[model samples]
Target chain A: MSEFLIASLAICGTFAIYHIALWVHRTWNHSLTAPVLVATTLVIVVLITFRIPYETYMVGGKWINELLGPAVVALAYPLYRYKDTLKKVAAPIVAGTLLGGIIGISTGLLLAQWAGFEATIVYSLTPKSVTTPVAMAVTESIGGVMPLAAIFVMIAGIGGVLMHHYVFRLFQVDHYLGRGVGMGSASHAIGTATSMEVNQLEGAVSTISMVMSALVVSIIAPSLVQLMM
Target chain B: MEKVGKMIMHIGLLYIIFQFGNWIQRTLHLFIPGSVIGMIVLFLLLSTKLVRVSWIEEGANYIVANLAFFFIPVTVGIIEYYDLFLGKGSLLILIVLVSTMLVMGGSGFFSQWLMRRKEWKHE
Candidate 1:
């Protein structure tokens, strides 16, 4: 078998296992995010321990990452369709995103500082709430670790998924717009994805928030890092 | 011929809106993205009855419905970094997990507070 074909099968096999786990858990009224992340990490660990080079994994896995761009462009339709509600809350959406972005970054930096994490790691972390591409760029620009930024993005996603419901209840944030913006600003894409499962309004609002948060972070992270430097 | 023209016009206008949105962000010196600014512009146009919602619904819905599929390529890129993650991955994981929880909690609380303030103003 050709290398590409073998790599493709391995990728498919990984996804198959992920989906099967998802299905089994769903039957019991459970979620797949936590388990899938844990499982993926475990599998990766085993692969690494066995001395499997990451480049070999990329032969097939790169195909999946290429799809993110078009997916973002695809979001335009929902935003257009739901323009009315979005307009009604535009002020709040902008306001909420700004506030959320500042708080998310500042809080992370402060906590990391309090814990005595290295400055470079802290810089890598400041953009954790944004999506991967943007976060990676921010990290690189600020002289931080790109791989660490990617991991931080995933952590933000899973964090949003795990705590969003409880946070909403605790804060009495019942409105779709508020909930969505909060998720997007805090968790980035993963939070935005899970928001879609809740409702279209949440999804749309969260999408806007995610994009806005990334933009906000792109502008501010560099300056903030400069200040720290 | 007219329908095709209108379809072309619609796409053209959307592209313009997207560009204009970016222009506004740059012009205003805001921290937000041009696409988001475009979303806001489109939403404003729709809300004020300048552009009917039906006009862009088809294109907009098409984009939104399949947002998940778009991220597949990026996620696949994770496979490339598997080795780096394999070494000292625990420290990386710990940082991500802890910081994420902090971001979500902080953002959620702040949003809720802003919502309450908005409600108070109405009352």
Candidate 2:
């Protein structure tokens, strides 16, 4: 079979497995997003390990990733629809975002350093809380590896999913708006997805946070890297 | 004739807003992108009651909701680097998995804590 066809089959097959898992675990009410993303990527990675080229995976996965832009554009509708509430929280949103951005980058760098990660890895880790495109660009500008940035982005997403609830509880962040913004800013898309489950207000704030975080990190990270170096 | 002129003016305003956003980013050395600055501008205008959100809602929504589509070209670039990912595939996988969990958990916790602090201040 053609490589594209094989990759398509692989992606589809992986999704099938993910859905089946969700079905089996439906009674438990667990999330299927993380599992699906991790499983699909894992399956593809395993295939690559056996000499199935990444080009083949890209042939299929490319289509999936391509949808990221339009999905982002779609966020405008909700933002507009909820402008009233958004307006009320505008100051806090921006403030929270700036603080979150600073804390996220600083904490990651410190922890990575404390763990004895190499300098290159430490630079790559700085943008983990940001979205992929911004993080990738920041990574490249600072001489960090692009693929490593991608890995970091994915890790950030998974982390957002697994620990958001516990964190929310621990911090006593009961307000839906604050919770959503925190999640979206910190975890990007994955956190936004989790926010959606909480409430529409949370979802909207999360979307805002995600987009803002991307823009903030992209512009800020490069300069921060230069200064730190 | 006047209404048509007004409509033209509104379009011009949006163009200026976008440019202004870009200019601010370039001039002020802000860490955020121009488009985002433009977004903040728009948000501010709406909040101050200077401009109605309805005026830009349609366009803004279109961009935000479908933001994911823009990443396609970038991801397609992944095909070019297939070899690199393959060469260190396992290590990459491990890093991605571990770091993602850490970022998600850490950030979530930190933000939540900040939120609580904010709440406490209010009380």
For residues A1-229, write the lDDT of model 2, one tens digit per residue: 8866776775575556545534544445554433433344455456557776656656766655544433443344466568887876676776677766766666666666666668888788778777675787778777787777776676566556666666666555667666777778777866775565455577788878877777677677767766654
Q: Please, what are the lDDT tens digits per residue for candidate 1 over residues B1-123? A: 876666555555666777776688779976455655676677668757798866765554544543433343344346665564665555555666665655555555566566678778999
Q: Which stretches of candidate 2 lie over 4 Å from their true place?
A: A7-11, A14-26, A31-55, A222-229, B1-123
Could you give the fnat of all candidates in order? 0.36, 0.17
- Which structure among the candidates has the greatest lDDT? 1
- What is the per-residue lDDT of model 1 for residues A1-229, given as tens digits with 9 covering 90 to 100? 6887857875675666555544554565444343334345544664567666656665665654443333444456567667777877777778778877777677667767766778888888889889776788788888888977887787677656667767667666777877888788888876776677567788888888888889888888787666654
Please identify model 1 stretches exceeding 4 Å from their true place: A7-26, A31-54, A170-172, A226-229, B1-92, B116-123
DockQ of each: 0.25, 0.14
Question: Which candidate has the highest DockQ of all?
Answer: 1
Alpha carbon deviation, residue A15, candidate 1 (Å): 5.9
Q: How well is candidate 2 docked (DockQ)?
A: 0.14
> Global lDDT of each model?
0.67, 0.60
